[model samples]
Target: MPIFRPYDTPRDGAPVLAAGGVSRRRLPLNFSEEDLPLFEDALEAAIPQTRLLELEDVGVSPEGMLFKDWRILPESFSSPSIMEQFLDRRRSVLKFLAANYLLRRRRKFGRDCLWIVDDWSAGYFHWLADALSRLYVARDAAKDLVLLLPHRYRQLEFVQSSLKAFAVGSVEYAGAGEVYFCRKLFMPSHVAPSGNYNEEVVRGLREMLVGFYGREGAGSGAGERVYLSRGRAPKRKVSNEGELLDTLREFDFRVVHFEDHPFEEQVRIAAGARVLVSNHGAGLTNILFMNPGGRVLELRRRDERERNWFFNLASATGLEYFYQLCDPENPDEGPHTANLIVDPQLFRENIRLMLAG
Candidate 1:
């Protein structure tokens, strides 16, 4: 049965593990009355129920696609809205058909398994904020539940450490170019809409992670400022980072690259930050670990005002949020991937204002 509108479909037989409701977020400090309409939908969005779906004889792909009897299950993709937003319809259809029809090798598992992998599970930001957050809802079953993951994901250190922290029973990997058939599959609905957050669930997950990995007295002290650098990134490079770094240094800011550190180390570094400064990117996702009331300064592209993932997160986590709009080096490259140019003088002004309050 192909579910085209999984969001509207009633949970006739599925059990509601975590109830859903509406949540409100405070607007970013820089937001004005004119920008209210732009964020109207997000300011108070409805969170979806975290329900458990029990399916028999379901075929699972390495990319987290699920199907039964050669038919796709839209709910397995998280939500129909996310599918339409991030995936190419024609390409997805072709891939699904090829996986079920052309692929011959299939591995069958008779034991019930829990599947949480999704299309965006590979990326660091989505892995933590979206994929792993689902565990919070399914935590009640974490004791003996076997998590199914892609073959390559089994080698990622962060993934391994996170699973350990969650106390998941065991893990199974789905091989590339082959579909695994599960006799019984246990899947959970998304805890929140993609890029949106549920404060209680998200904060709870963050606390659990910190409690497990956090070191005592790590990155401690007031007036401890940190700058997350995107210097190694292919796109979204800060053209004038050297100049910006010089100014940041005057204020005792320590610049670091999150990619260089282990998952636990990243948590420790973020734990003591009184202020965090970084361009709008995945590195900012670490704000979830920071102490509440800490300030966040996001160097956002002027045209990319609607991408408020970090803003909403700061609010949900009880952090004060602020943003400084920077110009893209090449506007033709587009807001999402274009390099940015930060004005050091403007940054100084913003920093002073942030510290004053």
Candidate 2:
């Protein structure tokens, strides 16, 4: 059976885990734990259990919350407070929802389903945290389950390969239909808008990932040092990539860019590392494959100060994660897409400490 930890559905039981609470108040309410934001919505759809009702119209529902229920999920630590800032411009959620929004398209599904919507289909980071774990939630009923996605996901090499490993065949995309329905629809809670990565999300996803990582084999490339490079970003180039690479090579670090290779190849390479080091980029998500007790040193952009995504991933996978803030290309300027510069001495010292551990 597919695994989703606290939100996992069972083979012979109610689809609705618990009846949710309701609210008429808006944001910033002093909410107790029992009074969840998505509870009422979940209750509305879950009341008629064993029912598959289809409406004549199907687009963004009037609710305006595609996956809000996930925040209230038992296994999720995300709470109603998050709803306050989720639609904010700074939150990536706004862009993600806008990108996946169906303007003049519709589709249908044949079984119970779920979807985790995002634009970066090929991004390993998005896959590990949102896409892949959401699949585990829907996989329990594979015979009668359909996963919805944008057409772009079909084009991604990692997306296709990951689906095959789990024997997943039921999938769909958005476009061109007046009526669309499903037996059950689950949209995983990314809760990305909030910069925090709580324990539940970490442990739950990691549990599902362990099986997939099993193929890497024991003691594969033991004590290997891998540096994930970000020389390919369209705008955020690593200005000191050459110097960093030269320094890392001196320590026997093998350089690899996840974007350069197929998804499986990337995982295969990441699986063997004892020390994985790189600038803060999507490739570091591969740290999920490394054996526990492995180490990660992330070179973060001082100006941008990104969310604690990989650090949480490392925590979940039992890898030791370390990070150092590096100056941006133009320190005087305001925030924009930018590269990073790491002090060579500082990085080498950190590497030395990592190896000693």
TM-score of each: 0.91, 0.66
Please give the range of 10 consecutive residues that has the lowest summed lDDT in model 2.
Answer: 44-53
Candidate 2 regions with alpha-carbon error over 4 angstroms: 1-110, 118-123, 176-179, 187-223, 303-306, 332-336
Candidate 2, RMSD to the unseen true structure: 11.6
Give the worst 10-residue stretch by lDDT in candidate 1.
1-10
Q: What is the C-alpha RMSD of each candidate to the true structure, in Å?
A: 2.7, 11.6
Q: Pick the candidate with the highest TM-score.
A: 1
Q: Candidate 2 on 222-327: residue-level lDDT in tens?
A: 4388888778776555688777766787788887767787766666677668888887766777787776788889777764433555655665567776766678
lDDT of 1 by residue, 187-302 (tens): 77777877788788888988988888874366447436889999999888798899987788788888989889988888877876878999988889899888789899999887
* Pairs clashing within candidate 1: none
